[model samples]
Target: MSVRLQLTDIKKTYRAVTALNSVSLDMMGGKIIVLLGANGAGKSTLMRILAGLEDPDSGTIQFNNQTTDAKSIRRVSTLVFQKSVMFSLSVYGNLAYGLKIRGVPEGEISKRIAEALEAVRLSGFEKRRAKKLSGGEQQRVALARAFLLNSNVLLLDEPTANLDPNSAAIIEKAILAKKSSSRIIIMATHNLNQARRMADEIVHIHNGEIVEASAPEDFFENPKSEVTRKFINGELDF
Candidate 1:
C-alpha cells in the first residue's frame, strides 16, 4: 500500500530568526517532490524535520493518516546530506553496519551491499577506506548506504550539488531507479536543470514559506506568484 505524509501548521524559530512559518505540505508515496529555494530558505530545515534529525517548534506530522512523532518518522526515513559523512572504515563495513544492526543475515548483507555499491557506480570499491575516497566518491557511498535501508521516505538535501557531471548523473540515475510505489522521494536543490529533470512536482520556497508548488512544466514556464516568477527568472537576490 502507498503511504502518505502530512505536515500541518509547521513553525520553527532559531532564537531571533524564524526558519519556517506556518508551513504545511502533503506528500504521497511514488512521487519525487523537489524543493527550490535560495540559501536559508528553510528547505534544509524542513528536510531535517522530516528526517527526524530536528523537530519543529510547532507542527503536527501525520504518516499514513496517523499522527506520529520524530522517533517514528526517523524509523521510516533516510536522509542524505549535501556533505556526506563517512565512518572510519572500509566501504563494505560502512554499508554493512546498518544491515547488521537490523539483524539481516550475513549472506543477505553481502548481496545488498554489493547491489547498493553497484547502483552508485562504486562496484569493487568495497575494500577502500570510506573516509579516504574523493568527495564525490564519498557522496556516492553515502547514497549507497541510504539505498540499503530502503526506507519509506527518502530525503535528499542537494544530493548532487558541486559534484563532477559524471558522478552527479550516476547519483541521479540511481535515485530514479529506486523510485517505487511504496517510497517517497523529496529533494532540495538549487540546480534548476536538475530539479526540472528529477522532480515530479516543483515547490518554490522563499523566506521560510512555500510560495508555489506546481508541476515542472508549469513552474518553469508559467509561475503564478510574482516571487516565484522572479526566482525562476533569476531576479530574486539570495
Candidate 2:
C-alpha cells in the first residue's frame, strides 16, 4: 500500500503534560492500524492531531506528497469521537449534512446515504431522530456518516468503547465493510482482542510515547517491549 500520511517528529503538550513526544510514523492506505494504549496513553491525542481537531506543538503533517493545512487535511479525513455527536436532526439529516455542505447533488446524496446506511446496517433508521437513538445506534449512525464521506482517511477514537458485545460486533463489521484500497483506517482501542481482530498493524503507546509497532501476529505472539508484553498480559492498568 502507498503511504497516505506521514508524521515527522510530532509533539503535543498540554500545560506540564506532554501528550506526544517526538513521535513519527507512516500510515499506509488500505489497512487498519490499531493504536493500542491505556487511557491517557496518547492514542486519542495522536488521533486528534491526525484529524486536524488539534495541532501538534511541533511537527509536520505530510499528505499526498505535500505539507497540508488543517482544512485540507480535514477535507480528506473524518474523525468519529467515542462519544457520538448528532446534530438535532434525523438520521438522514445527520448523514446528509456534510454532503449538503459540499453541495453534492440530491440524487448522489441519496445514493450515498443508502449505501452508507446499508453498510452500517441502519437501512430503516433514516427518519429516526439521531439524538433519540440509543448509544449504540448513535454510534452506528456516526459510522454511517463517516462512511458517506468516503474520505481518504478515517480516524476513529475508541469506536466501540463502552458498547455491548453485539453493538461492538456491528461496529466492527461496518468498519471492515467500509475498507477500500483508496482509504486508510486508524482506530484507537484499549482492547487487545479487538485489535487482534481488526488490525493489520498494531502501534503500542505508553506514557505519551510509541514503544512498539508491529504486525498483529508478531505483536500478539512475540512482543518486543516489556510494556507491550505487560499490556497484552493484562498486567498494566489504564
Candidate 3:
C-alpha cells in the first residue's frame, strides 16, 4: 500500500545556468527526505520542480505508477514556502479557502479547520486576522492550512527558518504529527540540527546536482563525500 514517486533524468536550466543536472531519485511511502545544500545550491529549484511551481526542462515524474502533469501532481501534493504567506483574511478564512475550492462541505470544512488549528496549537486564534500573527504564528498557520488540505505528499522549504526555539519545536511537533505511512514528506533546509532530528534520508545537493543520498546516521556520522564532510564540518557556506 505504499505510495511511490520517481523522477528520472530530471534537468533544469535558467539561461546559461543549469539549476539541476540529470537528477534522478526514487522515493516511497511515508518517509522524510531532507534536501541539504548551500545557498544557490539548487535545493529550492529542485523542490519547486517537484511541487510543480516550475517545470523541469526535461524529466519524467511518476507517482504511484502513473505519469502525471503539474496540475495532477499538485492535486495530491502541497508545498509550504520558506516565506509563508497568508491572505488578508482571518485565520479561519485562510484555512478554509482551499477546502472551499476543493468543494468540501461546510460541515467538514469547519471540522477540519478546528482539527488543524488544534494540531498546530493555535486552537483559539481562528477569528484573528492572519496577517496580524507573529512570524512563527504565521508559519504555523500556513502549516495548519496545509494540514487541512490533507494532501498525500507535502514539501516544506526552510520551514522553521529564523524562528525561536519554542516556535520551531511547536512546528516540528505539528510536522511529526502529520507524518503517516500514507504520506510522503520532502523538505529542503539549511538547518543541520533540524535535519538530523527530522530526516530519515538526507540528500545533499551541490552545484545543482545530488552528490549524496543516504540514511541520516550514515550521512551525518559517516558521510562518503568530501563535500558532505566539509558541509558537516561547517567549511562550506551556502
Candidate 4:
C-alpha cells in the first residue's frame, strides 16, 4: 500500500511542556490505526497536527507529495471531534453541509447525504432538527457529515466516547463498512476492546512519546513496553 501521510521528526510544544517530542511515522492508505494513550499523553495533539489544526514546533507533514496548510490537508482528510456541533438545521441539512461548503452539485449532495445517513443508521431522520436528537444521534449526524465529504483520511478522537453501547456499535459498523484501499481510518481510543475489534495497527503513547507501535493483535498479545502491557491489563488510569 502507498503511504498517504508521512510525519518526520515531528515536534510540538505548549509552553515549556513538550506535547510531542520528535515523533515520526508513516500512515498508509487502506488500514485502521488506533492511537492508544492515556490522558495528557499527547495523542490528541498529534491528531490536531495531522489534521492541520495546529502547527508543530518542528517537523514535517507530507501528504500527496506536498506539504500544505490545514485547509488543504483538510480537503483530503476529515476529523471527527468528540463534541458534536449542531447547527439550527435538520439532520439532512447538517449532513449536506460539507458538500455545500465544497460546492458539490445539488444532485451529488442528495445522493451523498442519503448514503451517509444510511451508513450511520439515521436514514429516516432527515427532517428531524439536529438539536433535538439525542447525543448519540447528534454524533451520528456529525459522522455522516464527515463521511459525506468523502475524505481519504479520517481521524477520529474518541468517537464513541459518551455514547451508549448500541450507538457505539452503529458507528463502528459504519466505520468498518467504509474501510477501503483509498481510505485510512485513524482513531484515538481508550477502549482496548474497540481497538481489538477495529485497529489493524496500534500506536501506544506515553507521556507525549510513542512507546510502542505494532500490529493490534501483537500489541494486545505481547505488548513490549511495560506501559503498554499495563494499559492492556486495565491497570492504567483512564
lDDT of 2 by residue, 44-87 (tens): 99988888888899989988668976778888899999999999
The TM-score, computed over Cα atoms with residue i paired to residue i, of candidate 3 is 0.97
Residue 194 C-alpha lDDT in model 4: 94
**Which has the higher lDDT value, candidate number 3 or candidate number 4?**
3
**Model 1 Cα shift for residue 64 (angstroms):** 0.6
Error of 3 at 189 (Å): 0.6
Assess candidate 4 and give its TM-score to the true structure.
0.94
Q: Give the number of the best model, judged by TM-score.
A: 1
RMSD of each: 0.8, 1.3, 1.0, 1.6
Model 1, residue 13: what's the lDDT? 97
- Residue-level lDDT tens digits of model 1 in 71-173: 9999899999999999999999999988888999999999999999989989999999999999899999999999899999999999998899999999999
Query: Each candidate's TM vs. the true structure?
Result: 0.98, 0.96, 0.97, 0.94
| Most accurate candidate by lDDT | 1
Deviation (Å) of 6 in candidate 1: 0.8
Question: Candidate 3, which segments miss by more than 4 Å at Cα?
Answer: none
For all candidates in order, the CA lDDT equals: 0.93, 0.90, 0.90, 0.86
CA deviation > 4 Å runs, candidate 4: 1-3
lDDT of 1 at 160: 91
Screening candidate 2 with a backbone cut-off below 3 angstroms (N, C-alpha, C), the clashing residue pairs are none
Give the C-alpha miss distance for residue 79 in model 2, angstroms.
0.3
Better of 2 and 3 by TM-score: 3
The residue-level lDDT of candidate 3 at 225 comes to 91
lDDT of 3: 0.90
